[model samples]
Target: MFERGTPGADRIDALRGWVGDGGGLLMVGGYLSFTGFEGKAAYRNTALHEVLPVELLPEDDRVELPAGGRASAVGTGHPALGGVTGEWPPLLGYNRVRPRPGAEVLATLGGDPLVAVAGYGAGRSAVFTSDCSPHWAPAAFCEQWDGYARVFGGLVEWLSQ
Candidate 1:
């Protein structure tokens, strides 16, 4: 990721190669992820874009839901859903994204891709398009929910495989 919009080709290729060689890539969402605030996070059209299971919007994709939005599990039978079962606590917000073809939509929030996973070459890549911490992931979702660990643990487990 570039601080000044410069995703150097070398870094992009290196990351692409790493993922292609079976490395697991996990992208967690936040103000600085997937075209964040004021279009600053900017992961729209890079090598990261190529491998991510979700497509990043060219503009800022933050959707604030102070009323909160709950995740709806959609990837039943997928390894990413392993032991993660039960209702999910409400998330404060998330980065809007679309699941690419062949990518499994593991979960959704506000009718958008909240968690998505895909295979790229010999590797795997997954994304949780919401903050793993604060603001978006609130205390209700992170601390008071058992499924929180189950969900993330499942994603990690699936990615590692």
Candidate 2:
């Protein structure tokens, strides 16, 4: 997670270099991830952007779905969505992102990309555009969603492959 601007140029370069050398990277979203709460994350202009599957918006990209939004697998055979089925728990919010060329969108929320995957050099990378813990994901998604482990575990397994 490239949360706030703690990573300097050196750290960003090191991370990119490491991932280019076959490291698997998984970026989890949060108030400090992606464009962040009010577009403060600012990852788009950094070296870490090289591995992201979506183009980060220049301004605040958060969408508050107070009524909640439904997310579902885009494709049935995607390994990252393996064993994930049924209606997902409603999400309270998420980052708005556009999938990059050659990137595969594995899941979506209200028609927007929710989970995306792509290849960067010799490694693989994935992005989950919603917070993994609170505010966006909601407590129900964290504790009661039956497919939670299956979805995330599949993402990790896919990256290892």
Off by over 4 Å in 2: 1-9
Q: Report residue 39 deviation for candidate 1 (angstroms).
A: 1.0
- lDDT digits (tens) for residues 1-161 of candidate 2: 46685754577778888878888788877777877777788888788887888888888878889999989877557888757877889999888888999999989987778999999999888999888887788878987887777888988998887
The model with the greatest TM-score is 1
| TM-score of model 1 vs. true structure | 0.91
Give the worst 10-residue stretch by lDDT in candidate 2: 1-10
Candidate 1 per-residue lDDT over residues 51-107, each given as its tens digit: 899999989899998998889888766778666766788898899998999998988
Model 2 TM-score, 2 decimals: 0.90
Q: Point out where model 1 deviates above 4 Å.
A: 1-9
* Model 1 residue 60 distance off true place after TM-score fit, in angstroms: 0.5
Q: How accurate locally, in lDDT, is each candidate?
A: 0.87, 0.84
